[model samples]
Structures are given as structure tokens and as C-alpha cells.
Target: MSTAYGLTAVSLVVAATVLIGMFGLRISRTTSDFYVASRTVSPLRNASAIGGEYLSAASFLGIAGLILAYGADMLWLPVGWTGGYLVLLVLVSAPLRRSGAYTLPDFAEARLESMTVRRVTSVLAVLIGWLYLMPQLQSAGLVLRTAAGTPVWVGTVLVAVVVTINVLSGGMRSITMVQAFQYWLKLTALAVPVLFLLIAWRQDAAPGLGGDAPPTFPERTTVSIGTDVTVRVPAPVTVEVRGRVDGAGRAGPLTLTAGEHTVARDTVVTFPAGAAVPHVADLPVRTDAEWLRPLAGREYPMYATYSLILATFLGTMGLPHVLVRFYTNPDGRAARRTTVLVLGLLGAFYLLPALYGALGRIYAPELLMTGRTDAVVLTLPGRLIGGTLGDLLGALVTAGAVAAFLSTSSGLAVSVAGVIAQDLMHGGVRSFRVATLLALLVPLGLALSVRALAVADVVGLAFALAASTFCPLLVLGIWWRRLTVAGALAGLIVGGGLAGTAVAWTIIGGPPGGLAGALLAQPAAWTVPAAFAVMIGVSLITPRSVPAGVARTMVRLHTPETLAVDRGTWHPKGA
Candidate 1:
């Protein structure tokens, strides 16, 4: 792909975002406007904006990458992601909107009537938001490197700066329009490339995917190893090497044995057509049939699948994008309706990424060797449909990739910055600007420092963290009047501690194998249930600690504004 086209595409996306944000700036004169767009967004528009905000790097690039590496079971990434929205629509949308809060911390304080609960919620939301933002930045870096050969840090810093500017410019109001537009662009970018890609695939006689043989290079291919990687080949293959391999600095034809071998950074190897693809040391080795089969080539597949389900199905409720929908909607009804519409929008958008993933297996098997499977989406268009058309499609996809991260990152920056400004600092635009910088910078640094985990896996971990920490709090605080301040705090601590530790373990290198590793790698199946149990048990044991006026609060949460009650008469005291 041409660097000019990629850079130009990215430039246009940034310019459009800035211009749209400036339009929003004109009307964002009040705190409410900046935070929630004064709750005037219509269902359709709000749904589109949420689509932009919700479909992050995970949806655009990471899902396809994981699908390529993990096979059919990885379809759960999209299934779980969309099903998670269904969970949000069914369980969270209306009440969360009816609560009339800008952030999760705000809702916690109002519903539980406890400063301690509020502060804990704020801290967790910030932590989770920052955790979630790292992958978005990491993905930005990956796409940028693939597109332009720029340093990885360049993409990371670029996304951080763009998101901070958008968030600081008009806050929620500005980002609403910017993100809504991006959602459509992202859809087009992915959708258009697939048409050409499929055409090209068929022209090559449409190779069957059900064969038991391991995927081999469909044609002679030269792959540049961007970094040092230990690859495990399934069969012996001779390759022309241009750099160091296995600690030898030779430049000639070499044969890699059918086992683990190291390729140093900047090494370029040319494989003969039909040579079997090698995989990174960590990736599962599987034949085509095994790779395509559901639950194949997995460790503890049942537990991992169920844990992923719980994380995504329950975890999405705790994400910032969900809150953005409610805060920007006119009422609970609109929020609920917008969720239903988003179900369609998100569903349509998700279908395209899977195609990219499946086709990648046939066309770009080299990615497994480098463990840069996340580059599958951007890598496919150019390889499948070569020459000028491929380059243009690649550039369009590059722009869409930028939109993916920028839109979601903007939402997260706003969500975290809102908490920092409203809860930690003064209540002004200046505070919001400063908070935006701080909220994004921390995650930017993390993305720069850590580069081991797959972007999708890291994102899944974030989901587990959110599911464990906040899902119980929201479910109980909104629906169960018996929930007490002590219980909420206890639940947050237990859930956050357990999940946070699991996340840290996975990131810093956990146990090498067995059930213990699987449990920590995907902790939601246990942690989420434990969190609910602890919160309920503690709430029952400390009934007297329940907030006063619990009945009224419950009524307010469940009742609609259409009822003959004053909406503004009761605000959380001292909040």
C-alpha cells in the first residue's frame, strides 16, 4: 500500500472530526451541554453516535485478527460483543438513563447515598477506562505502522492527541456528531473492501477452507519479521533469508527444521509457494479443519468460552459508551429505543470483520508466524486484490481504522475526564481539558510500554474487569432496594480486587499452563458470580446500613418521567 494514500486517508478523518467538533462547540455553552449534550439527542442520532463509540479497535481490527488466529470459536468475539449489547438493552439501558447521571460514579452516589461508594466507583471507572484505552492506542499504533512504516509510538501519540483535542473541544456534544459520522465511514470502509476481496478470492478458484492440511503460502511470499519471534513450523521448508535466524547472521538459502526457530528483528525470509506457514511459539498449531472447527485447538475451551460470554454479555454495561448513550438521550425511552437501533447498526458493522478474518486465513497465513495477527484486516485487501485498486481499498480501510480508535478513544477520554473534572478537580471546561490530557496520557504510556498481549485478549480482560467490578453494583443498586452502602463498597472492593489481580497476573505473566492459568486468564465466570453473591450476602447481613428513602429512590429509578412527578425536585443531597 502507498504511504501517501494511507496518510491522506488518516488526515481527512482527523480534519473531519475537528470540523464537526467545532460545530458542536458553538452550542456547548453549559456544563450539561458539554457533558450530555443537554439530553436532546434523538434516538437515531444517539444510536449512531454510540455505534461509533462502541465499535473500537476491537471491532474494526482486533476481532478479525483474533478470528484469523483462533478460528471459529473466536467468532464469539463478535457474537459476545453484539450479544453484550442485547444484554445492555434488556437490563441496563432504561434504568441507567432514568437515573439521570452523567457518569457511573454519579449514579453510584445518587442511588446508594454514600460518598465512599461514589469515590470507589469513580476510581474503578477511571481505572477501567484507562485499561480499555490502552488497546485502542495500541491498535492505532499497529494500523499506523502497517499503513505508513511510522514508528509504533507515532500512532499511539497521534490517537491520544486527536482524542484529547476532540474531547476538550466540545465534550459530549462535539463527539456525538463526530462519532456518528465515523460510524458510517467505518461501515463503508470495511464493507467496500470486502466486495473486491471476495471477487479476487473467487478469481483464484475459491480455495476450500475445510481441508485438514495446515494453511500454506498460496504463492511465493517474502515476509519481513518486524520484531524478534520464535516460530514453530509444522514441516521442514527451505527459505531465502536476508538477516539473522537462530542467532546466525547468514544471508542465503536456509532450511528451518520442523520445530521452534528464532527469527531476529528486521529479518526478511522468502518462502516458496505452498510452503507450510509457521506459527509463533504461543499460538496453537492446527490443520485447516482443526482451525475452522468450533472449540478446536483450545485449552479448556468450555471455561474460556463461558467466561468470555459472561465478560462480554455482562461487561458491556460497565463500559463508557453505554453510559454515553443514556446521558445524551432525552429520556429512558429514547435510550432504550436507541439501544434497539444500535443492535441493528452494530450487527451490520460486525458482519464485515468476520469476512476479513476468514479470508485472511486463506490469503495471509504469514501473520501467524509474526504473531501480528491484528494486522490481518489491513493486510488482507492489499494481498487479495493487488495493484492500484488494492492500494486505494487499503487506504480507505486505513481511514476506517483511524476512525475506529479515534471515535471510541474520544468517548473514553470524555467519560474519564468527566469524572476527573467533576469529582477530583473544579467544575469547568479548563478542568475538563486538563483531565482529558491526564486520562489519555496514562493509557498512552501503558500502550507504549506493553506490547505482548493480543489487542483482543487485552480488551477481553478489560471486559472481565468491568464485569466483575461494576455489573453487580449497577444491577443491585438499580433493582434491589435492599442494597446497602456497605454492600456496594464491599462488592466493589472484592470484585475489583479479584479481577484487577487477575488482569495484572495475565499482563505480567501468569502460570504457564493448566486450570489455574485458564481461570486467571478468563476470570469473569467465577469473579462475576462471586461479586454478586458477596454483594447480596453482605447487603442482607447489614440491612440497617441501607440508605434512607430507598423506596422513593427505587420508584424514581423504575418510574417513567411521563408519570405526574416532578423530575427535578429530588437531587442527591451533598452531591
Candidate 2:
């Protein structure tokens, strides 16, 4: 049960990543190298880097934990997270690169021709970047605390220092090599242990890995909403159960007829294992709702589904850290190819977490009692494969976990540095260094103060915010000639304000239940549409606010590659 191997593996991965980053530092000389690897990254290399940066703590750890805690209902977390990249591949990748902008704000200013819009977008970009970075830092803390017995803050500080050094020293150009290498490192770290664990499981005769206790009774272990307790029974059974009703206030015995049964509160029924349970024939049936139901009696409204879907789909396009990766590519074609490759890499990485979640259900059901199901993936590996092999497997998982935190934090710092350098420091070298430090500060502070936030929940808030504020800006700015500064500002203010307010509530107030809970948990449903509507509505009102070169910009954004490449006239706005 000692975690020495886990600690050693994590330390080794971190050291290796830093060493690779230092190698990039040796070759990177120009400002362009620091910012975008001088825009010369190949498709495969950039794709691996994207995969490395994209697989944050949430994807690496939180998804499996969510599934272990919530049952099949939580599969959407991984599905939505991975599917977001597909949206990126189809809708945003090529056009975004062809825009000749280094960052989201740059694209906004060039397309809208408005300094105000640019500044507003910059602020939102930083906010989104910081929000996303917080989880990575917090997860680092979790990994160290769980695996190495280190204090929670130790991991956060370690990651922040390492990532800051890499970003400040060599920027994207250097981090690119580090992330690309880390991607393969992470894959190996995960894949090797899993293969060994499966072999061990088979060799061990696949014992009943789960707890010896029988499953909980359906009638006694019912889901309670307010005063109502609902149980799903498929057959007839006799059991002893106690039910209570508000205002009725009395314990009673209930006998059920075979077909369907509804028991009032303060009623008790007892049935032994293997008894035939009566089916609830009259209750309205919902197959999808059943799949979506929370394990611990939690309920999310139907609208929440739309909110989550919108957040996942639109959020990827607007993410500042994700957007920055496109700039690392040499041209539009490379960007498109990178996005496609990202889909494959992400899809493969997601499969492991789902397997881990399933394994946790069978091997470590007690995780539910601990209320930290997120640790299930990390913990279950040790249980299934014991002794030296299990220890090694735990170590490998730890390395992947560390890689997740490092890759994401580095990308976020780069994005934050880019925005600060361009806007505040007038694109000067001194400004980039200052921005990098400042970028690390905001997330570090947040991570230290808010150590208890669930990784997936915090990440979801980031996605919702990104969808509301940045998604519309990127989509409309790239594709629409009619998009104006006024429209973009209106959309950002309305969309960003709503999403930001929701995040604030999530941080300060915490989720309660029902519709309010759904809104706070997933704000993208209303916020995204509200953003798009505001942009379109305001654009209609002040048509003249549209920039004069809108048509030309759209032509440049959408023109065939040969035409634009032949002109040799396309230069990044800032460059």
C-alpha cells in the first residue's frame, strides 16, 4: 500500500518534461520562437502536443471518478469532453488558423476592427484561461497528497514553478516539444499498467473483486425527493422497509399487491435476498432518465442536458489554451490536421477512464462511502494488481496524472502570457515575462484557496464560460461579414456576464438542487444562445458598425489555400 513507486514515477515524469523543455530552450532564439515556435510545427508533432495539453486532470482522473460515483449516468462527462474536439475539427480549426491571428483576442480585433472588442475579449480570455488552469493545479495537489503523502499545496507549488520556468524561458516553442513528448509518456504510463493489470486479473482467476456485502435493497434504498421516496422494482418481493411522509408522521406496515405498489410514508416492509419484488407498473417510465439518474438521489432537470451539450460543443472552439495550440502550426492545413489527430488521441485516452470506472465499481465500491470517487481510478489500480506489479501500475497512473497537470498548466500560462504581452506590454519581451508570472499567480491563488472544488465541476464551469463568451465571437468573427464591433461587444457583455456570474455563484454559493442547481452547474444552454442572439440583434440595429474590410477579411479567412498561399501577402495582424 506504500506509494513510493507512484511518487517516484510522478517525479520522473516531471523531471523528464522539464529536461525536454530545457532542450527546446537551447534552440529557441527569436521572439517568434518563444510565442509560436516560429509557426513551424508539423501536423503530427503539433497533434501530439495538442493531445498532451488537452488531457488535463479532469480527463485523466475526474472522468473516471465521476463515473464511479454516478454510475452510467456520468458517461456524458467523457463523451462530451471528447466530442468537443470533433466540433473543433469540423467548425473552427481551419478557418481559425487562416485568420492569421495568434490568439482569440487577435482574431476578434482583426475581424471586428474594434479595439474595445479586442480588450474585452482579452479580459475574457484571461478569465477563461485562469478558470481552466485552477483544476489542473488543484488536481496536482490531489495527486501528490494521495500518492506521495505530500501536502496538498506542495504539488500545486511544484507544478506552478516548473510550468512557469518552461513558459517564461522558452514559451510555446519550448513547451511544444515537452508536451509532445509527455503525450507519449502519458500513453505509455497508462497503457502498460493496464495491460499488466488485466493479465494479473486473469491469472488470479478473477475473484469477486467487489465487496462481499450484497447489493442494497431497492425498496429500502430508494431515491428521496423532498418527502417522496421512489424505488425501481422489476418483480414481486417481500421486504422490511420503513418509509416516512411529511405531516403524516407515523410508522406503518404496508403489504403490496403483485402488479404495482405505492407505499405511503412511515411504512415498513421486510424481504430477504432472492425474494420476488413487485414491479412499479404505474409509475411513468423513462429509459433515458433512468440512465441519466444520479446514484445518490440527485436530480438534474431536462434543460440541464441541453446546457451540458451546448457547453461541450461550443466550449472547445473558444478555449484560449486550446486556441493557442492552433497558432503553433505552420499553416491552416497543419492546424486542420492537428485537430483531426487530436480527435483520435483524445478518443483513445478517454477509453481508459471508462474502464477504470467500471473496475472501481467491481473492486472498490467503498469509494462511494468516502465521497471522493475521483480517487477511484488512482486507488483501484493498487487493489486489482497487488504487490510489486500493483505498485508499479499505481506509479504509472501517477505519472499520467502528473503529465495531465503539467501539460494543461503550461498551455494556460502560455495563453495568459500572450494576451498580457500583446495588450498590456505592447508585445514587448519584458511584458511577456510579467504576464507569465501574473498568469501563474491567479490560478495558484485560486487553487490554494479552493482546494475542495470537484475537478469536473470546476472544469464544467470553465466550459460554460468559454461557450458563452468566446464561442460566438470566434464563430461569427470568422464566418460572418456582417459581424460588427457593437454586436461582438454586446454578445460578450451579455454572454460573458451571465456565464461569469454563474461561475461566481458556483464558487461562492454552491449548487443546491432542481432548476437553479442545473443552471449553476451548466449555464451554457441559455448563455450560448443569449450570446448569439445579442450579437445578431445588435448587429441588425447598427449595420454601419460593421468594419469596411469585412468582405476582404472573410475572403481571406475562407479562400482556397493555393490562392492565399500564392499571394504571399497574408501576415498575422500583430506580426
Candidate 3:
């Protein structure tokens, strides 16, 4: 039965994508159409495409899972993710579009008037693009394996082939139509199940615990501290226990010693359930938790906050898939309008995932044991609804999950392919064809060899890379007239090197904790400012190195839309 449902959904999605691609193919005539839809996309349609492509596997699956594991604190992930668009809309959208570039590298070259900067930007774009694509492929493999008991790689290969064909055949134009359709398809896929599950939950009287008895604690619970010490509690307790120490760095079991005892490492204390529990809210503002609230935990420190901010803000602007959609607009004003529409569409879609997370906290707490809370959103349908309705809902979620993977992977592949063709092969039919194959193959190979990282973690790494590299280049090159080639290179080396190292550590060593962990997890706060500083300082020291056409470029970037032409001369207008 599961196989049947899976096959049916897959067939329908493929058929729809092919049909859409064929529609695009009939109208797509020139290289310009394939690359940027001849820069004619309307604001509304472009916005839908942006929303579709932007909500990758991480947004669809990872956010709910993180919320399930971390409670309300995880809400920041989605909030940060969506807030990124707001920052992009305000700071970079119009000016970036007005630059009249096909990709990030194009803008880097045009603005900086340096082939060196263009090459550097292109390399970073491919890196970020591939890094982002890893999670999407992994998610595809996971969905097929979980839903249909198929070999994991089946889904990955299927998607790679389909996306490659779509991109190779029609490029950005084909994907825009496909992604716009997918956005609605995904929303329906999720919304339908949610509505049905809500109905089922209500019809079943919305019982607390879903007819299961409350969990009972064991007669005795053991509390372990540091490396070795353990204490046995006679009953369940909510108490703060302090420890004491002796010399030689060896501590005995936790006990109240004579006069004054200090809390020691490896000490364990236990209390009964009736004991006083620490009330975090009532604590003084100077309490450790209060002091550390800005950081997610002691293990992460300031890195967590900075990482979130960087991922949310800089990451949005750096994303190649997201940026390419702007190229589809008729002009800078249309791009700005498209971004505004995306903000509304994304804001609406985000609300549902939060709802799912809240529902999972109640209906599927057991997900913690599996350590795969990412599946909570998928499993909730069956648990909340029952029998056939539950199965149907589950299938719908499976479809959405598949769509998330396909749409995101497709977009990233398109960006990577475009960059490769333009920078490496000099942008033509042959370059596009070869680049398409390389784009799909490289990421697919990486996805196959590596164990699947958490979706958000992988996506965050992509963001960190973008923040370290492109974010600085874009922001500074657009706003700062003093930006020099030397400075951009220096910043790219320092910021990009640091961010890239952190990503490597994350992938190989797993999530770093403590200060190093904080740095690895969220290098953005430091890296972003550092990149900007380096760019400015270096440019200041070498004023003569500034691009010769700086004034003209600046004029184009800030001029109003009324002065801009549809074909060649582009200019930004007042917000």
C-alpha cells in the first residue's frame, strides 16, 4: 500500500513537471530566455517562483524537527530564516537588480571591474551552491527510503536526472515555471493533510495523550555529573544540586561538608520530587541562565546568536538560487516588487510549520528517543488522524517533502550550472550543456559518499560560506565606492577561509561546542564585519586601485527606474 501511494505521487509530480517544462520549451527560443526568461517575468509570478525555490528541504522538514527537539527556542530558526528576506528586500534587492548582472560573479566583475574578483566570486558561488544542494539530495534519499522502502539513492538519482534535464533543456525560464507550480503544489500537499488531521483530531475529541497513559518514572533515578560521579534519588525531583571538591582534582560523592562547601566537578546531588525546583523566571537578572540567554546554551556561547543572525541576514543575499530569480524580472523595480511579494508569501507559509511544530510537541514527544525529530512533521498526520485518512495525510506530506527536495535541488543546480557555464566555459550552448552535467554529478557524488548531516546544519553551513564570501562582496561593492580588488581578495581569503574552515570542522568533527563550537556553528557575526573591514581598509590604503568606472557604476546602481532601459541601461529607483 505504501509503495502504491509513493509511486502514484512520484508519477504525478514527474508528469506535472514534464508538462510544465514542455510548455516552457515551446516558448523558450534564445539563450537569453533559457538563462533569465528574457528579463520579462512579472512581479507576482516571480515572487511565487522565489518562494518556491527558497523554501528548501531545510525549511520544509528541518525547522519542524528542530522545534521538536529544542522547544520554543527553536522558533528563532524560522523567524531568522524568514527575516532574512526582509533584510534582503531593504538593503540589496533593487540595487542588485539595477546592476544588470546574470549572476553574482557578473555583478562582482561589473562592479569591481576585476576578473580576479569575478573568478573568486564564481568559485564561492559554486561552493555555496553545492553545499546547499547536499541536504536537498539527502532529504530526497531519506523520503523515498522512509516512505516506500526503496534504496535511499533512488530518490537522489531520480531527482538529479529530472532536474538536470529540466535545467539543460530550458535553464532559468523552465525552472521558474516549474518552481512556481511547485510552490502551490507543496502548499496544497501540506495544507490538505493538516486540515484533514485537524478534523480527525477534533472528531476524536482531541484527547490529551491520545489514549496513552501518562509515563511513570522509575522508583529510583540516577543523576550523573561530569565524567563519573552518580547519585541515586529515591523519587522524582526538581532541585538544584551543588557539589564539593577535595585536593588532587578528585572529588567524592556530593555531600554537605562541615563549614562551607563549593560546587565541584564530577559531583552529584539528588532530591525527592517534593524538593524545591529552580524557577528560571524568578531568578535574578544576573543568574547564569539569564546571563546566557542571549546564547542558546553554555556550549554554544555568542556563536549561536551570531550564527543565527548571519544565516538569517547575510545568507539570504548570498544564496545563488535566490539571486537568480531576480534576473527574471523586467527591471530593478520589478525585482523589488517581487521580493516584497515573496516576503508575504514566505511569511504565510512559515506560520504552518510553526503550527506543526507546536502540534508535534503535544502529539509526538517520543520523537526525542529516535533523534530524528525531523520526521515529526511527516509522522504527525498518521498519529493525529487514523486509518485511511491518516495514510492519505501521510502520503500528502511525503509528496510535499519530495517537492521540497526537488524544487530546491533544481534551483541550486540551475545556479551552479549557470556560473560554471558563464565563468569557466564562457556562457553558450555547449557550456550550459557541460556545466549542467557537472553540476548534477558533483553534488550527487558528495551526497552519496557522505553520511547525511542534519538538514538545518548543512543548510546553515551553506549560509555561513555565503556570509563569509559573497555577502561582504555584494554589500560592500554595492554601497562602498572605495572597495578595491586587493581588499576584496583579502576579505575573501580571511572571511571565506575562516567560514570554510568552520564548515569543514562541522562536517567532519560534528557540531563544535564551547567557544570553538560557537565559532564553527556561527562564524558570521565575526566573519561578516571582518570581511567588510578588510575590504574598506585595504581599499583605503590603495585608493588608486579603485575601479576606473566606479562613478558610472554607482550612478547606475542608484538612479531611478524612470531613467533605466529594459534592455541595456539599468538603474535603481527610490524605495
Candidate 4:
């Protein structure tokens, strides 16, 4: 990989992003323009922007890594991610746009008619936004470190600063253009490289994927461990080491037994051609046959798969960054149309990552050992076809990776900042600017402090929290008509508290394996239903707590925009 090329690509992306923000700055004279692009974004453009912001590091990098390491079962990640939008389209998109709320808190206040509910929703929105943003920041560091050999913090700080600048410059107005461009840019970057990679594969006789044997190095390979790692080797093999391994400092070939061995930080191990790749201890071990089959590939596979589906399927609607984009649409109909188009765009883009992952298994199997499976997309071109062309392709991928981080982080920052400004500050431009700083800073600090979880797993945690809390509130508030303020607040507290505890534990020190660990790791399956039940039960118990405006709110949420009915409209503070 060429650092010069990687750095150049990253620089161009940052400059272009800032330039787009400047363009938005010219048109953003009003608060509405800054907040929701004056609610005038067209369906196609808005859909493109949604695809851009929704496809984060998890989609671009993490999904490929998971596929390469975990095998067939990991396909559910892309499926669930894209299908979550379907759930959103059918359930919440149009009605949410019709609510005429500037932010989630505004929606809560309007629908529930309770300031307390608004405050609680504001806190959850900020929390979910931050949880979502943290992974984009961490994955930015991973991409930069792999592409340019930069320090981890360099990428984290760089993305944080760039996103803050973009958000503060024009907020949603500027980000819409930048993100829309980014979607195409990312699609081209991945799509073009994969075509070349496929050509390369065909030139080499198109190796078959079904094999009973585990992935093995095609040639003698040297793997450098960026961080200390414990790996599970299936069989004993002699390997040359340059650094600490198994509590011994060795520079000569040594035999490793068939078990777990710890490789110290910065260690380099050379394996003979055809040596089996060892997986990181953090990942569950599976035979090649098991890896090829769904449900058999992972521990407690059925439960884990179902939990992932539950989280992503119900979670998309609650994501603060995603929901804010719907508010940019001119009307409820445009919002629905935008969601329909987003489904197509996202579906098309997702096909490429899975291809990269499967190819990675054949071409760059050593990544499994290094536990840097997340680098599969970035490293594949360089490994499979080395030369200036490989470097160029790798740089294009690097630029796309940077775009993923920048666009998603910028959107999340804007959503978080908007909530903070509207609810916590004076709801002015200056307050938004300050809020932008806070929004980026908290997650940046967290990204630096916490050990890196798999990028997709971190995102899954955010989805679980969102699913458990906001999914219930949004669904019941819009449809049930009997949802009470007390119910919404209680649901938010109970669901958020439960899911947040699981997320914190997963981050700090994940729980030990068992039924408890399985449940904690993927909390949505249990937590989401619990949230709905609690909300419904509390609402039934406290019937008087229902908002007096429930009927009006329902009419406003459900009425077609084509009809000339007067659905109540609430303007922002200054509007």
C-alpha cells in the first residue's frame, strides 16, 4: 500500500466535503434551512443522502470482515440492515414526516404533550446518536492506521474535527449535498475495485469456495500483530517469530502446539505456505464445513441470528441520524418515496461488501489470525494483486472508507447537536455550533478510551438500545392512540436502562458465556418486547395520563397531505 496515495485520497475527500458544506452555507440563511434543509429535499436526492449516512463503517468495512471470519451466517448483517428500512418504510416513515416535529423531542412533546417525556426522549436520542457515532470514529482510526500507517488517534481526531466543521458550517443543508455525493462516490469506489478483483480471480482460474479444509496461506506469510492478541491454532506448526510470543522472546522458528497462544504487541510471525490460519480468541472457532453452513457456524447460532434480526429490523426507525433525514423531505409522501428509493440504493450497494468478504477468505486468509478482519476490504487489493494498480485501487477504497466515516459521523453529529441545541441550549445557530463540539467530543473521548469492539457489534449495540427504547415509543405513539405520557417515559427509562446496561457491560468487559452472555450480547430480542409490554401495561394502568390531544395528534400523523384537512402544525421556537 502507498501511504502517499492513501493520504492524497483522504485529503481530497476532506476538501470536497468542506467545499460542499460551504455551498450549503450560502443557502442556509434561515434556521429551517440549517435544521431540515427547509423541508424541501427531493426524494431521489434525499434517498441518496440516506443511503450515504446509513452505510457507515459497519457496512463498508465491518460487514466484509465479519463475513470473512464468521462465514455464511454473517450474511444476515447486510440482509437485516437493508431490510430494517423496509420495516421503517412500512411502519413509521410517512407518519413521522407528517408529525411536523423538528426533532425527536419535539415529536415526543407534541404527541404525548409532556415536557418530561420530551426531556427523556432528548436524552435517549443523544445517547443513541453518540453510540452510533462512536464506531464510525473508531473505524476511521482503523482505516487510517491500515491505509496510511497513521496512529489510531490521528484518524479519530481527524474525523471528529472534520465532521464538527461540516455540521457547524451548515448543519443538514450542507450535509445533504455532501452525503448524496458520497453515496455515489462510495458505490463507484467499491464497485470498480471488485470488478478488477474478479478479473484477477478469473485469471487465476477462479478458485472454488466449498472446501472441507480451513483457509490456508497460499504462500509463506508474515503477519504483524498491531496489538497483543490471543489466537487459537488448530494444529501444531513451526513459525519464525520476531518479538514476544508465549511469554518468550524468540527470533527463530519455534513450534506452536494446537491451542491458544498469546502474541505480544508489534510481534511478527512468519508461517510456512499452506499453514492453517488461526482465528483470534475473541471469535468463536468453527470448522470449515460448519463455517460454510448457516446456524452451524457460530455459538448459539439460532439465538444470536434471531437477536441480530430483531435489533436491526426494529431499530432503523429509532436511529436519531436516520430519522432526522426524513424530516428533510417536503412532505409525508416524499418521505415514503425517499424510503422506497433508499431501499433500492442500499440494496445495490450491499452486494459488493459480501463479495469482498468471500474473496478475502480465498485471497487474504491471514487476516483471520491477525484479528484485523476489519481490514479485509482495504488489504485485499494489495494482497491479491500487488503493484501500482493495486495501490491505486487500495487508495480508492481508502477514500471510500474515509467518506463512510466522514458522512455518517457528520450526520450523527448534526442530529445529536440539533437535539442538544433545541432541548438543552437556546436553540440558536451559536448554540448549535457549541452543541456540535459537544456531540463530537464525547464520542471521540469514548472511542479513544474504550477497547475497540468489532465495528458491526458496536453498531448492533446502538441498534439494540434504539430498538428497545424508541421503537416502542414511536410505534405506540403513532398508532395506538392510547399511549400515555407516563407510559412513554416509563418505557424509555426501563428500555434504555436495560439496553444501556448491556452496552456498557459489552464495552467495559463483556459478560462470560452462557445464556446470560448470549442475552446480554444481543439484548434486543428480550428488551424490545419488554419495552412494548411495559409501555402498553403502563398506558392501560394510567389511562388519564394520555394526552388530551391524542385524537388530534393521530389525525396529524395519519392524514394524507393531498387532503385539505388541517392537521395541527407546531413551529420551532424562532420560526
The per-candidate count of clashes, in order, stands at 0, 20, 3, 0
In terms of lDDT, model 2 sits at 0.75
What TM-score does structure 2 among the candidates reach?
Answer: 0.84
Q: lDDT per residue, candidate 4, 18-82, as tens digits?
A: 99998788899877777888877788999999999988999999999998889888899889899
Q: Compose the digit string of candidate 3's lDDT tens values, residues 187-232.
A: 8877787777667667867644222222221122233232222122
Ranked by TM-score, the better of candidates 2 and 3 is 2
Question: Candidate 4: where are CA atoms >4 Å away?
Answer: none
Cα error, candidate 3, residue 550 (Å) = 0.5
Candidate 4 backbone collisions, by pair: none
**Using lDDT as the measure, which candidate wins?**
4
lDDT of 2 by residue, 1-575 (tens): 46678778877987887787877878877667777787788888998998888788888888887765555656777778778888887778888888878888888877877789989999999998999999889888888877887777899899999899878767678898888887887777667767876676678676442433323322232221211233444444444446642224333443343443444533444554433332222122223234234442235635665677789888988888888889877677778888888888877877788677766655554444334556766786787777887887888888888998899899989988889888867676677888899999989999989636668878889999999989888888877778888999999999999999989888777766667877877889889999999998998898999997787777767776677343324454446
C-alpha RMSD (angstroms) for model 3 = 9.3
> Which one wins by lDDT: 2 or 4?
4
Q: Write the per-residue lDDT of candidate 1 for residues 23-49, one digit (tens) a residue.
A: 888888877777888788878888899
TM-score, predicted candidate 1 vs. hidden true structure: 0.98
As for candidate 3, its clashing pairs are 236-273, 243-264, 512-517
All candidates' lDDT scores?
Answer: 0.87, 0.75, 0.72, 0.90
